[model samples]
Target: MHTIQQSASQVVRQVLAGKNLNQALSVLLSPSAGKNGLRITSQQRGALQDMSYGTLRFYGQLVRVLDQLLHKPVQDAQVRCLLLVALYQLLHTKASPHAVVDHAVRAVRKCNAAAGGLTNAVLRNFLRNRDALLTQASISEEGRYAYPQWWIDTVRNQYGVHAGEILLAGNRHPPMTLRVNSRRNSPEDYRAILARHDIESSLIKPGAVLLAEPVPVMKLPGFFEGLVSVQDAGAQYAAHLLDVKDGMRVLDACAAPGGKSTHILELAQVDLLALDKNAGRLELIGENLQRLKLHAKLQCGDASQPDGWWDGKPFQRILADVPCSASGVVRRHPDIKWLRRSEDIKGFAQQQLSILCTLWSMLDDGGMLLYATCSVFSIENQCVINEFLMRNADGRQLPIPAVHLNNGQLFPDDHHDGFFYALLQKNA
Candidate 1:
């Protein structure tokens, strides 16, 4: 029990210290706690995990609830984190608030001598004002920077008011998605695998699967065997739309932890070159390939200046999954809601446009290029594609209809991550 409190507090402290929540938790639980020996129950372990993920997911709202309930600030690192954990349960979890307060008060006792009275008083205050907090936290920007104000405004402006609400709805929870490894298992075979494990999932498209209840990959059948990868159903569609074929010379630019790159390889036997600026992440890409026994030429290089690394020979197909604000995956990384600023969006747009222009020139004549980003904002999606069409004199934007989603604007919306794909075929 002492170890559980210490571990939970350590995880929360790292989150408050501005480390990524998932990475922080991994560090906290590395090889399990205890300097010498301690036996932690699965229930306790699950609670710590839930407390960490839940608190981060609703961090903006929880802090507001805490502020409303507490008079003096719970400033001690452990005490503050205890409050976050407690507040997360009081508002979000089905656990009784009294039980949550009891456990948190005990955890606080382990923190500081002064924390017991403060924790008791603050949690008692919460019980009294729960109704008011629910109303305030849900509406105010301070209470819910879980959704950014400028992002809210921009969504309203670009997509109109109702669509703005829909956009927010998109971040409420993560969509469960899967990418079928076409080399080992087709979409149909993967769904059958899910059925064999009593895990139900719907096939969204040619190679995409959407799970209603996402099990841990370890629990999923054949996960270690890499029969399928947990990719956004929308992202799964990229390799398919890319039209990678047997023995084609292809470049998967900006590929790190190579999901799409591997998917491209799975779809067809191709001479593929995968490059990213980060060498550390390249190892992860290599690990995924090793797991699947898939082969590809993986290198680390800047996508904006591929000439520094790439040979002069041009490729028949290029998959440029460029960097962006990653606003679409916010549900899975709630810290982004607080970390991102309205100013950052414009900077990302500028960089994304620069990358598009740079990589577009590298596409061989008569070759096709698939430009993708896991960003929901139009400025980073269609805006970049539209601007490219206007700026390029020689390159013609292939006219595609809304149905093909190749119309220079493909927003992957069906049971997938919010992704934008632009397929451009250079004229021969």
Candidate 2:
């Protein structure tokens, strides 16, 4: 337990220092192959992940709560972060207060004995004034929603009357949605398979399944056999929007972890080339393809520099799921709320424009390119699309049904992560 608490606190500290949660946890929790590697059990690792995610989920509010109680800013980053982890348990988890405090006090001593007294005092005071402090923190929208003030304002400015719903949705735990691999099993057949195992799920669309609760993918029947995959509902639209057809050439630019790349293959017999900038991440695409028994030409190359990889062949369809602030998937990755800044949106928009313009040339004269981002920010979505259309005469924005031309925003909900998709077509 001490190891678990220490590991969790360390994960939070790493994230606060600039690394993402996945990168941070992998450093502390991932077991090594050698005998010298840390031997952490599954239960302990699960605890560490839960505490780290929960701490970041309420990070904005918890930090404000600490500021309200602290007489001065904590000089040691680890000490303050440990307090945040303890506070997360006291407020969020069902763990006993005595055990939580005791473990935290011990964990703090393991880090810095000089700050041990401070940790104990702050935690106890919080227990006494928990209600009032939470109330004070809840007064501001940022505090109430546990998002950065700039994030709250930006979403409001873009979403207007729906801003509150969008902000609140990011804080809610996202549902576990999966996409069935049609080649091996239909959504209906997969649903029956789940029922046989006493696991309940509802189909949101033809190929999408929404679980009542999140489960380990390894436990899902036929998961290893590639009968289904873990993908959100909004993401499942990519393959459909791309409209992959038999014998058509498709380019899944910026495709990493290959969810849509695999989905495209499941729908059609397309000659797909999945390109991503990171070589290591391209391996993820390979892994997913191997699992689904799907095939795609995987290459590591920048989408903005097609000259490096493109063989002068035009693709019938392209899926440009560019990197962005990821404001939409905060529920799944709460660290994005802290990691991204308001100004970063401008940089992302510029990159999206570069990739969209570059990839546009690689598409067949009448081909379609679906621009997507797991972001609700307009600058990265419609603004980028609008700017690209203005600069290119051959490219025209194609309207997506039920999606606003200016905001193809899919607000975060129980069924899907907040996402934006703008399908563009090239005209001769």
Model 2: per-residue lDDT, tens digit, 113-150?
98888888998999999999999989877778899999
Off by over 4 Å in 2: 32-38, 403-407
Using Cα atoms with residue i matched to residue i, what is each candidate's TM-score against the true structure? 0.88, 0.95
What number of clashing residue pairs does each candidate have, in the order they appear? 0, 0
Error of model 1, residue 155, in angstroms:
2.5
lDDT of 1 by residue, 1-428 (tens): 33464566677677667677778766655665455333456787787777777677777678778777766676687778777877877777798777777877787787686788888888888888889877887787646545556877776686674654445554465777888776677788888878988888887754578887867878877878888787877677688788887989999888988888888888799999989899999998899898888999988899888778978888999988989887777666766666677988889888888888888787888889888887778888888888988887656655444664534433324465566787888888
